[model samples]
Target: MFSKIRKAYQLFKSIDFEQLDKLSRKVDLPKVMDSFSKLDEKQLNGLMKMLEGGKPKRELPPINGDFYELHLRLSEEDRALQLKVRDFMEREIRPLVNHYWLRDEFPFEIIPKLAQLNICGLTYEGYGCAGRSSLMEGIIAMEIARVDASVATFFGVQSGLAMGSIYLCGSDAQKQEWLPAMQQMKLIGAFGLTEPEVGSGAAGGLTVTARKTEKGWVLNGQKKWIGNATFADVTVIWAKDVDDGEVKGFLVRKGTPGFEVEKIKGKMALRIVQNGLITLTDCTVDESDRLQHAHSFKDTAKVLQLTRAGVAWMAVGCARGAYENALDYTRKRKQFGKPIASFQLIQNHLVEMLSNLTAMQTLVYRLSELQDADMLRDEHASLAKVFCTLRTRDIVSQAREVMGGNGILLEYDVARFLADAEAIYSYEGTKEINSLIVGRSITGFSAFV
Candidate 1:
């Protein structure tokens, strides 16, 4: 013990503040100070070995976004795909994400690079799909969202909702017609489910009416919060049949007469995604465009079941993004003549954020596993969606708290995450709605009226 103490004292004595200040520019000073303060003599010596340009007995590598080492558990092919997607997100998306997000525009230029990843329509069996597991798809969602939520939402609508609708419900001929091009990103698709008045109650209360006509089917209604609708080549519009009153899905091609899309404005979150308010007034579709397997709302629920889990993964990504940024900021930011990270309260905030982030990571990991096993249910997806999004709200808020005023600034990165978390919390299904799903499963009582 005495030798350990002596070594620690020697290590501290050798620490060069000048060197530390230079390296501090690269790392978090507050975090270093906090770690330094907590170290006993022996630990201090070990840290000094790394910090003071000495040959150390032990060395610790840099921290990364994957705190739970998720990549390690993935199959080699899936792991490679994850990295490829991450690189694309960081290189192509990250640089322009904030600018497009601020201007409320999509960067159409990056589509080609994104297409090169060959990740579109992931988890589908054929039509040029990679046919990967749900776990890989969820991880890709996280990777994209960790950089930008808008891009992730855009991808989700296309890959999980729009294409998934066709993949799961369309006839083989319909799949052959759309999936290949969509998989190549040659054709963009959108899913139109929520109506202006319906929102979460869309399943049972669709006001959009589809009337059978001698020519074909005429769709008349409005869809609100429809992602990618403004510029999509095709949209899957869910409407109730006028004759049978059964909810049916239609592939409404763009430029169809009476189908108009007006971009929704004033969105503070997911600003880069071109959400559209679509009005269908006597919009006609061929009988062939109807999704044959979509007999009722039950079919739509299947698409949501797949994407809701991805939303939970996106929530985890958002929380992780905020936590990492906050952690990086707190270590560099100084207060009270030392790094603020040296303060107990700041460390407490970080620990809390990490704990929530870690819990979310573990939960989503297992959630994806269940999805891969074909055991995913509405309640299972809802539990993850509710838990992760709620905890993400808390995590991002605490992340902002630790960063002080800088947390609110967009340039700092945490502010955008904080703002984006709000939209994620409400979209897909509200926390209350999702909780009710779990509530119904466990308690056998439906709380949603």
Candidate 2:
């Protein structure tokens, strides 16, 4: 006991007097010393070792998809807006996505919350829009999709496809009538372009025909896989004019005579997005309701080009969400009495996922830069769409791979991303179509026909 007291006294003498003084305020130092003096030799040695701190634990870097730090390149204001959208998504969207996704329904209550962000029509000028650069729009899209791709799809339909059609191809009257309401999300919108029979052949072969008459123009045909159409207030319908054989755009309002919409069911992926099969049996749209400037397929392509770029950005978000969730899961999940993330095989999968995700992020950033510079062409958008979406598919699949059986379980989130990636893969443009667009641009050959 005397030896223990001597050792404890000597140990305390070595501690910094300043630290001891600070500790006296919080603890009864005299009582501590008295207790320490009564300890056995083994206890004294343990106390001595604790006083001399052991080896420091190393801090590892966080897991992030933006390995190249592309988000840092955004201007201060743009970065703030990006973070705001990310916060909204993470807070409002993430918690309820799996529930809604499993039920195949949208959370309509979020529309007003989404409107508060003031991001709709972000790249367009005037009409209550932000009129920000396209890069900002891409970042916003990525952030929204990083939580739920179905919500992102609904937004893209409203902001990009529906509003972009009017912004790029509508007359002054049409813009004034629609852009503001849509920008506020007070009026949800959808785009009807892909027909049941005509998927990739929409450029020259639209079966939906519009016949001109003194009363109005009569449209007859069917449109399938129209996102948001089940609840959209308005849809931008593309039809071929039988008189001149030219493609024209029309703002077909809800409940129009002879226009019928049937909600599609049993979708394998992106089920939360309300896709509709629209039937126009002699539906009459006013002459003024037609997109005044959309005279041919070339005019329609303008809107597609704009939205396709946004789709590429959305693909990045889906891959990012998957990679991040899978990365986090690996860290917590243990195998063989250790974290699976520490395993060489698991680390290889993680590194491969990160490599693809980083590449996608950097490519989309440059793609948005080109768009903001007004130098973006069809091939440019198509290439990014092709690469990002293709890589996103692979990244999500690998994310599932690392997660083992839990990857398919919805609670883990990678499963949702994995399922949603299939929808992103086919929408806006398919891989084959986009690749051909790039191929034609590089080779100067018309392979699409």
Candidate 3:
């Protein structure tokens, strides 16, 4: 029995004895191990081939953040701009983003370099815009958020939401006057829509009131979560018209009488974004400042339509950032005498995260495609927004989980993503709000009250 045990040890060295014992019920281990031990070089090779037979080989393509080959689809000029922005983000933003996030402060120095990207108002035709495809614009948004979500939010407000208001709703003269300077980032813009008491319900519940007087329009109300409002040269404010009861938009230039902005502090997510609580006490603006094309809440919905798709792209970027960082960390982190990634349970978590991330990437790609074709509807963007943000929350959580105790540490990087994902989930639209948008479209019922 001692000799047999010694020989069995040699044969089953690579295979666990416990596993071999389990296999003994199916195959006589004594005979099998003896045969395995006696096999010469040629016979051993043949036996190995037979054991692996009939299993199809799966050669997976290399993992990449840009799953749909979007960079290759861009024109040379646009591709160059994309790379320039990516380079700027990697060099200027990546190094200091975590620092700012830790301190909950904005990095003012990087603004100049970011302004140099010439990507603001990317999809708008004329008015100093590159007039690129919406797909390219979406790609740039993804790239920006992939590095730093706060910066992306800053740019999105200045470029898409704020500038887009003027581009889509302002008069022809307003576009000519503001587009060039804003595009160059010489004139920064902020959007004021959500109020201190209203958020997702801004469509019908804006507390800000705009009363027309001999001087102009008097705006009296408060806005909350207005990004970049603290330092913006111009803030696009949406308020209810006193006479017509329709929601109207105004281009309230900075320093307007009765207009004030105060920074909102102690935010757990998107800390780098200087969100503001704006107050308007009889803030008067010239008649020309009123958005000529913005007749009602439906018009404001259009602006949201354009920006919501970009938010979905941002969600994809966030998940990708967390995934890449976690994957790299797992490969390098060792535990129990081997890489934690080599453990079965850890691998399962990783695969789950990757699966969700891949699904999000594909969904956003399709969403952007639909948007570029001008076939995108609210429900289309809403679906992607709901799906991606939900998945991003899950993916980032798993990312932190795999990091263990270091997951909660800001220096580890994944922790920032985990925290910031909460903002992404709430902003643009909450999970329930976005789902209701999609549900209304598919079921032909308006569930939002």
Candidate 4:
């Protein structure tokens, strides 16, 4: 009798108390328990299993911002890496961005942890890189920008612009000397191609002059708005050859004589990027320091071609982040005794933002596909850049509009997006420039003056 009693006690102890309490509110628990107690061991086990089966299976919430479920297209490994990067960005970069942006400082402390992720130089082969697909790299760019545009820009300069210059144009010796440490994040890099006067016409118009002599190449000119230059270990400087009038690249090491970098101040957007105004007055680089394969502006364009797609991806991320935050804010912010999200006009703004964001995401996905297939033309990436950044401006504007007055506040996050979108619109290539690139491609006419 005692053994049976103990067994019954054990079974009763295993009951879900909260569920029982819920059942008690709707039914007579005492009667239910009395009936339940009469079941023998086998019957009780079956009954428990039946009760468990009646409960609903827990469903996972859908991933936000992937409105078209595009992530399902990624390979399993690629998807896992994407999620890992997303998790890191959410946990490490998101919370700290506004503070750094306000201070206009880079969180140099995050480098070690970020380096541990082993994501830098993601699409490059060997030299400690993952050698992943261009599509995966684009996805990573999107994830980083979704947290902070400055972080994404900084990473783009390092991974796409700086490292890509080396990978595509560097000699085997240069690649062996630089890429491994850079891929590990132990050595930071910068790309100096834009001049104070040569913004849109960087290809054939670089005024920075490089004179080749017996000693080496002497770089003389200024590069403005160079990201990561303030503290980068290496800065890739593009200059017009004094003799040939062709463009060439030089790896200008830090603290090289006459290579002076002054931090660009008073930036309204991408404040944490640490952009620099580089003044290279008779900066002498060894003959060996020149990019072996970069013989002309076309070679330099190859580097730009690789990075333009990343810029487009970053624009998409910025727009998506703003839309997601605005959507969440609307659901919680009350107006007219209900959520603002319930209003028709508010829905219109959200739909516009979402539709644009969705379009940007899909377009970049195809752009990256072209890149992975090695069929990506300059115009293809330019079209994506032109389309994504232009749509991002519209989407971010709608996101700000829906959030009302709170949208302008930095704490709300969309205001940052609002300002950052303007910068992204002009970077890599401006809308007019990119549009002209696409125009020349399809129509066989140069629209760019």
Candidate 5:
């Protein structure tokens, strides 16, 4: 009897006295206590657990941005490489970007690490390149931009604009001299074409002039908004030949006499990329250094068309990163009792963002397929660039809207993506120019000022 009384007392101590008192008013408290005293040890434990609400709520699966499982389409090897690049960006690039972006400086330390990947000149046939498909190259561009878009811009300038100029246009000797080193990233390159005055009018009216000289070609003009020019070992300078009245490309080495570059500052987007304003007063290039095949503006346009496709891929990365981050944020943040994501409006915003992102992804994938098949045209690339970048702006804006106060904070990362999306939208080609290119193809009209 004493043992029974001790067991009952122990069980009574475990119960919430307040709850017991409330129950006493509604039921036979003595009867409940008597029943608890009769329960075995295991049964007592089960009762306590039930009252404590120890059963966990259902857990959801992780949030993955790949809604349509496009990765399933990749072969085993291609998907492995894609994940490798994605991991590298997340581990190495993510931690350094916000710091460099705030100060408006490039993270020069990452160059050696990037070289280790051996991904530069990925699609070109030789010169120590991977010789991968355009799909792989576009995947890499997307991965790099997923962490930070400024890094993507810097890479596109080097791998696409600069090296592509040499690969497509440089002679055999020039290729042997530069391609291997540039592919290994032992030598960095830049593209110099846009000018302070002549931007959209570069094809017909390039102010930069390459005049024939007894020594070589003397290039005289200013090239503005040239990425990597400040530190690039070689810069591909496109100039109008005064003699032939045609545009030509020259490989102007860094520190060449009469070649000067000053870094452009005070940018709100892609701050980590070093854009330079180049001033050339009689900058001379040897006959051998000139890109052999780049004899006209048409050659330059080819390089632009190819790189424009890469920019479209990069824009998709920026949107996906923002959407993923915002989605996770909504799930964690709460306003009343449940996660804000539980609200109907929040789900609508996320679904809208996912819809746009999936469309951009599928479109770029097909764009790369066309490129691999060699069916890509100027209009095809321009349409992708126009559509992707424009959609990216809308996606990032919605991402920021969901985060409210936290969205603008750089720590949240959407802020940087937002700014960099602006740069991508403007660069490669402006929305108006790209749209006109598509418009001209469809309607057979050339409307330009």
Candidate 6:
């Protein structure tokens, strides 16, 4: 007993007195030492264990899909902006997602906070836009969808489809009028392209008709699945020119005499996105409101081409959200007195999910690189869309599978991602449609016809 005390005393002496004094100023070191000095060998062990009980529990590293550390490749400025968007999504979007999705309601309350992020027109050059790289834009898209696909879809329509239309096809005067306010999100925007009878072939064939008049152009058509149309301040309505038999775009403002919008309801997926059925019965748009640079369907295709890569990134986000949630659940959920994550089968599912997720991340990283380099093509974006959305469906399925019955519950979050994946798979462009686009590129034959 004396020997043990001597050894403990020697160890105490080894700690410098000055260091101890400094520590004493911050903590009750003398009291702690006195308490330890009173303990016998077994008592010391017991006291040590008790002290440890007050210490923070060991925490596991967060589950992330970026196994290759793709985020590190971004420049410091870009990386900081990426984290800002991610923080916004986590803080603003995540909490409200399940609630809004369940009620089929849009959270108008989030708009001002969202605008504060200054990410609305992320990649545009002029106006109040960030004028960031395509890579940064893709990263932002992934971050948004990581929390909620519905929110991501709404954002994509506003920033990518709507704003991109103006940036790519609107004249200098038109851009000056809309881009600044839209960039600040003071003026919300929507893109109207797909009509009731015209969807996949919207590029060449649109049922929406546009007639020239001295006053302006008269637009008559029905647009279906037009996201954000119900409340958008400006909706870019695309119509076929009656005289030239070519597609043209018109900036149709809200409350236009013949413009009508009905909120599309009873949706099973992405319910938070306010899709609308817009009817234009002789909706007269001023000639000045027309997208002057938009001469043909080809001009409209440019806008879709720019935004399609973003859809692919959004798929990666959906899969990542589902995978991470499932992984967390498996680690905590016990079976046979052990965590399910310990089971070989559950680990297999995790590995598969991670593999698909990594593939998607790398693919989109390259896709955005191509975009930034101005070497991106329609087929490049389409391939990524086809691959990522397909893999996301599988990843979300595995996420659900690992969770057993709880996976289907909205509280689990995996169910929403799974349901949203179906919408992503079909929207923008279906698998078969995008596949044919790629097929034509490789074979040098127009298989789409």
Candidate 6 structure quality by residue, lDDT tens digits, 291-360: 9989999999899999999999999999999999999999999999989999999999999999999999
lDDT of 3 by residue, 397-437 (tens): 99999999999998778888888888988888888999999
**3 or 5, greater by lDDT:** 5
In candidate 1, where is summed lDDT lowest over 10 consecutive residues? 56-65
lDDT of each: 0.89, 0.92, 0.87, 0.91, 0.92, 0.91
Q: Write the per-residue lDDT of candidate 1 for residues 198-274, one digit (tens) a residue.
A: 98898789999999899999999899999999999999999999899899999999899999999999998888899
Candidate 2 C-alpha lDDT tens digits along 1-449: 78887887787687698988888899998898789877888888877778778555557679677888887888899989988998999899888999999999989999999999999999889999988999999888999889989999999999999999999989999999999999999999999999999998899999999999998999999999999998899999999999999999999999999989999999878988999999999999999999999999999999999989999999999999999999999998999998898999999998998899898888888998998888999999999999999999999999999999988999999999999999999988899999999999889897866
**Clash tally for model 4:** 0
TM-score of each: 0.87, 0.89, 0.84, 0.87, 0.90, 0.89
Q: Which number leads on TM-score?
A: 5
Q: Which residue pairs clash in candidate 4? A: none
**Where does candidate 1 clash, by residue pair?**
8-41, 29-331, 30-331
Candidate 6: list runs displaced more than 4 Å. 1-43, 46-59
Q: Write the per-residue lDDT of candidate 5 for residues 278-365, one digit (tens) a residue.
A: 9999888999888999989999999999899999999999999999999999999999998999999999999999999999999999
- At residue 243, candidate 5 shows an lDDT of 100
Record all residue pairs in model 6 with backbone atoms less than 3 Å apart, i.e. clashing. none
CA error at residue 113 for candidate 4, angstroms: 1.3
Candidate 1 TM-score over all chains jointly: 0.87
Residue 362 lDDT in candidate 4: 93
